[model samples]
Target chain A: MVEAFAVASGKGGTGKTTSTLALGMALAEEYDVTVVDADTGMANLLFHAGLADVETTLHDVLVEGGAPVEAATYERFGMRVVPCGTSLAAFEAAEPERLRAVVADLAADADVLLLDSPATLGSKSAILPIVLADRVVIVLQATIPAVSDGLKVQEYALSYGTDVAGTIFNRVRGDVESAAEKADRYFEGPLLATVPESEAAQQARAAGRPLLAHAPDSEAATAYRAAAARLDPRDGDSGDVADRFRSAVVPDPP
Target chain B: MIPEGELLRSRVVTDLATALEDVLDRHLDGYAVLAPRETLLGAADGRGVLTFEDGVPACAYHVETDRGGPAALGDVGAGPYRFELYALEAAALEIAHDADELRVPPGMPAERLAGDPALATRTRRRAGVDADRPDDGGALEAFLEDEATVERIRESARREARRRAEEWGLGDALADRPDG
Candidate 1:
């Protein structure tokens, strides 16, 4: 019984990987967490987790005679990181349903799964994987267009009858008070968190280290933690949230 | 919601294969096509996978065959099945995360029915479509977006199929997905 959250931002550079890895570490205290490389397009979650040399990865699992799922699965801050790994192109050639099937298998093993989706819907070539998640968290920066894009996704989510957890303003700069207030008012759900822009963050990703691991005390880290704290596994209540997905209906299902 | 990694399962893999096979049969019919035993739709390295075609081809081909008979309309049975199959591949496109409209172009049948439940009212109006209003009730353009409106979608598809059947001289009653 897996409770999954899809971290989506239609626009790039929204700190989706940072949030995913940070939440992966933060959520580890309660249950078995796994980060799914749902970002099949340009997967970079592994690099953020600092496990570049991973051996038996998902790419291998897709092909014949590859390592086992246990072998491909690795530990990251008490949580497991299912490396989508290299050889991604070959897997994609297999197509969407196959990709969704593979992603479903990985999500089944974890108590909670965090999917780092690509920013562009077009980049979301692996469509089934996104729809498979129990929840979708839209991460956005402090910009009108970004929030608007996130809202559209939120509207699409309404058909499922589940409200999007809310938007997280990543890399916020200056005292944009009005912008923040307006953005909050515009959203249908909570505006979960606001992460400040940090030079340390730019440095950490550049140095290939997670901010929570590299600079735990950073302001951005604190914001991430606060946002992370809001996500209560208890609220999900014994896998009923994701398990009872049938209660949610398709949006505009023609 | 399906979890991220859950798709990697062998059992799920078989289920997906079956779904895709059904899609192939629904659209391609008698055409020789291969559904890759396994397809991967993941993304990594800053780019989504390609080769995994998510959009309907912009091209459409109308092949007239002597053996298909004058009344046969479009023959997806033999050569040039790509266009016809693509036209009937709305379900396949949905699996690919593509919201392509089979009734739109290239693959769209000349005639369409308003049998879709979502558009039951519109479906009835489009029953005997006239060409002056191309976007009229019976045209493919009149179909709604949500496929979950099972009756509307099927009725819409039926109308389009029927229209095309008439234009091409093919008879009525093309096998459409039942409302079950």
Candidate 2:
């Protein structure tokens, strides 16, 4: 079965898109992965993936009655991407609920699908991705507000019957051990991985490439690989922390 | 029928209608009577039928001069002799294609707009409107008169309504409603 993971955040500028790109590239190392830009309003994933000027986008598929498969831009870091348009008119015209069919069609071809969601809570644009995905991975900084927002998103996802896969603590500055423990306690889900603040991330962004493809040996890239390993469904020990936390905290779904 | 130039000139009449609405709402206790000069003139010409767009008085109108003169009303003679009021009606239209082009962020390449299918469609539609517009100072009239432009606006409104209904989980109920 294909595992669809939605990378979302409570607030903007939390490195959510960056984490999605890195994790997608790392996961593509061993599996067929497709990263979808589900942020219909302020889409930037295409720019980061060097497909900014792609002819077709998710807007065309969702709003303009174009085929979903036609929107996919292949061969970007050995992964497929359905980038969203950055036009306000397109944003106004799109039907967010139509993403269900798009994601379902994409999931059939790929082993893993990562949805890069917008950072808005309760809005149609943000909720559609979470509702359509099998699980959600929240990307957040190691701060009170960020962690609080991530928990709210986790709660929102659970309300819709989707599972909270875990949280990725990105751009961890100074110490890792304390940040990991704090993140684990606050997130209520597994602390999947904590990526360090590195110049390599900036360099990779500047070069319009994924961290793994730009600097394979970089610290940030290595952390993403570890995160991807835990995300792989083939591994039996992948979701131990998440399973334990879910059982302890979340009641059995009706 | 109003001349094309007169219809185009009605664009400025929006301000007069707004002013009349504001003044009447503040002072008048009940309904106010205002008639377009064309309607009065048509009545004098023995034409019984007077037509206006959507019940809005078209063209200019002044205060009734036969009502015991201006000084008979309090402070009427101290002000201007002629008062013009034009009833306003809302008209929906598509945004000009160049609107998105103008909003493109500084330092960003213009090619990105061309690559986006929806933006391209909007730009193309606006371009079509611009190309079809008459150069003889009746652009607004031509735009409103164009069947394609009016249909595009209607289609956009329908799509917007359907999209909203779907988002709120009311699509089934909306579909069950009687067709317009």
Error of 1 at A157 (Å): 2.4
**Per-model TM-score versus the true fold:** 0.53, 0.54
Per-residue lDDT over A38-95 for candidate 1, one digit per residue giving the tens place of the 0 to 100 score: 6655768778877777766666665555556677678766778876665646555423
Identify the runs in model 1 with alpha carbons over 4 angstroms from their true place. A64-66, A86-88, A91-96, A123-127, A234-254, B1-180
lDDT of 2 by residue, A1-254 (tens): 46778899977767888889888988887888889998877898887787777787787777656655554555788899788878877767776656656666676677778889989764555555665566899987644335545666766565455677888877654333553464465444587888876788878778777778888898888988888788754332224322322222111111
Best by TM-score: 2
Instruction: Calculate model 2's interface RMSD in Å.
Output: 25.2
